[model samples]
Target: MLLGAERGAGCYAARVLAKRIIPCLDVHNGRTTRGQQFGRAEHGELRDVGDPVALALRYDEGGADELVFYDITATAEGRGAMLDIITQVAERCFMPLTVGGGVRTLADFRALFLAGADKVSINSGAVANPEVVRAAAEHYGSQAVVFSIDAKKRPDASGWEVYVAGGRKATGLDLLEWAVRGQELGAGEIVLNSIDADGMKTGYDLEATRAVARAVDIPVIASGGAGNALHMRDVLLYGEADAALAAGIFHSGQTTVGEVKRLLAAAGVHVRLVQHATLGW
Candidate 1:
């Protein structure tokens, strides 16, 4: 069923698509980890939550619409996508999977697709040579290529600038401009991740997210700051994001996909809720 955003926000008659709930697994050294705003393990902040495959199974059974797995350190470590783990998770979980990090060429996309990734996200590689995204889109169809941008608000709070290498390198690319360019290059989606809000759950960067969503025709997945179901609601209605991605909250057992969807449905946000015959909603 289609739903409308906050009618008071001027979307009273707008037909909003069913919002997606995507759980992201930031795997570091083969273990799923969580940290505040891109904190590393060496800084005594990043904490290993559990096995990636185990968590994937949990989200899959908990009613997640999709799952995203990022080998957080893959780019920094100069490696390829985690094919073995991805294959393991894909074999067990029925949800679509989006894999990012260490994806640099057509070979990477081919390997990921063969390994069971429904979509491949590219960042630094796209910056270095946007043709990678264009070529991948042409070869695998636009729906399989997602241009993921890691952005941090400028020091003066003027605008967000793109970052790469796991939010460690600055690219000086304006977020909105890059998003539009990505869409022009045939990207199927834009995963706009806010570096400043990476793990802080107060709420999403609504203002920034809306700008990107309005600037691109492709679906925009807002990443980095979802504390509760209400936050997800705000981002979709006010931020205009097609989906919201969260990590620490779900990984720390704060909430499950079912609980979030239940709350969202109660608030009039359209989402795919799992059915139950014994315990009907």
Candidate 2:
């Protein structure tokens, strides 16, 4: 089991202990949008934020360590147009990219990887067929396959439950069990998104996140409920996540990667501090 630490322990542990700051871009109908209250199972307030390629370039310039592009409508729409956007962004942005949404088969994963995505995140598809995780890991290697679980706390139940179809459908699978299964199937990373905490910006659902993190051996990314730099730090340090992914706070110019790093440094969390030219301001 990985020992949970304060802000600074992991940075010098020879384990590449730096926490990742990932900014998520939710594209719907080819436009950027900000969803409210967990960004799950609901439509967001859409913004015609020009082209994805342009925004991706801006984030790259703004010192983002990594980028996540989620085609918010792809699964519902039953198409793969997000691949075009992923290709466009990957060609222009010189950083790692993780593309999610509408990825159901090995072919879907292959297409995204071929399009230059460093990783592919699958949520709904993996729920529909758990074996998808094993097949993806076999074909693309474990590191390239990311299992994204959107979960919400069940007051009546003892633990959180996984939600599928963009959080509209609930699966009775226990959160920890699913997480362990994904790891056993050779998943390189686990993105545990808290449906209850998403978009609320109260900070990440540390309890739920910690449960999953403790269950998995690979890197775990805590998503949902990131409002400020402190929230990011809290999640990384307290939740024991390898990374924290957020959308709204960064999208509306409420925070920048540089600022987030500075805050993390003050809190003693180890993060990559980069100097870059500012954009869009």
Candidate 3:
């Protein structure tokens, strides 16, 4: 029975693992893109890298712990196709998927979850209707709700301000206050996407990430500005985030999930070594 007790301890240790590595896929007009900045006042150069499904499959096969798909368009035309893409990716992927972009109401959250998304991430919509998060959590459980907050540092304030519509519009809300409010509204997790550091590869905005993580009890996923394994480790360790989400670095073949995990292990961050499985190998 002592051996059984030891095994149980190991299982508990695994459940408490720190620093998850999540790969992000930015989809624009039904195709995958890379190196695209989050905040653009007008149309920006969005270079199509490949198909979303193809890229997601590669990340899944490369042992990504989770996958996030963000649609970067702002029109009815873009919305219809984005759902179709989500459906296609969901049908093929075996891992948990989180989808965001243009999700405005509890109905939107329900539709996305019904389309096979494990979680629905709300950004602009949640800001518009703060009650939507609570409504979603009430109906779909807290685990199914995620608040994606895109923030840019305001010159007048010491903290960041929330931005929406692909970071094209600034809401002037205090980042810390909004994070606290999101937690109160029953958001399961928070995805703090940094507009200032996005596509810059300078490393994550640790100050912003840590502030939100410290303000809320839910898991915070740091998005944007991951250039390498060290960047991931810095965010997970110093930023106090539960997970680090990257796009360009991973999509461009600059870093692999295994390499990041090994580096984190060396830094005393607990991470699970996931095995990738491919169908019909």
Candidate 4:
């Protein structure tokens, strides 16, 4: 278990901060759900899992380093982060929580912080005005700001293009260019979520992740497409990502945070120690 001094306001630990495991909870219509490839459900409809708070508690028990609560429909619907859910989860879970989806202005960031969010993530908002990244990072410090980029491979397979508004709107921004811009604008970290690989559970897009990781000086969190421990290991080591984020695999009980961390540790990767982990637990 994590000690009192260890669980601070910041999401990352002092030492093993970059190499960490994060679990994402995507909520649609107030219920936690999972789908393939950014809203495309392979089975025709999304699998409504359960309450997000319940899932957060379960992931917390599995020893996730950080938890991300994304209101999947908030931005598309033109609203704000789910304060009710954030407050509820913050009241219970001790781990760092990042809330995103529909965060537009500085006031939105303030409200999220007041509700006990450790970090505020902005996707469409940042794309709309890159200056917001600088403003938020300056006001709250880069540590509290997470710039999330949803990218899809172009039709010509030349490179990836950034997407926003629930992956329905294309911004025509190059992945590497925007990643560098986000860092230049003072983003503490960048979450590179692949539209093509999301929820596929095959593995992360290593080439894209490595590119973004190398492009930005800040920590790059590789999101989307996590199947098993080896897949995560490949991304963290080979992909050169500072961290890995997953949703479907863990939500479906195919794996747990502890399981992934154990594998990474056994492979000589640095990860926060969890209870019962052989590597220093």
The predicted structure with the larger TM-score, 2 or 4, is 4
Which residues of candidate 1, in runs, are more than 4 Å off? 1-16, 276-281
- Please list the C-alpha lDDT of all candidates, in the order they appear: 0.84, 0.79, 0.79, 0.85
Q: RMSD (Cα, Å) of candidate 4?
A: 3.7
Instruction: Mark the regions of model 2 whose C-alpha exceeds 4 Å error after superposition.
Output: 1-16, 38-50, 277-281
How many residue pairs clash per model? Answer: 0, 2, 0, 0
Candidates in order: C-alpha RMSD to true structure: 6.5, 6.2, 6.3, 3.7
lDDT of the structure predicted as candidate 1: 0.84
RMSD of 3: 6.3
Q: Estimate, for each residue in 79-146, the C-alpha lDDT of model 2 and write its tens digit.
A: 78477787788767766788899999888887887777878899888888879889988866777778
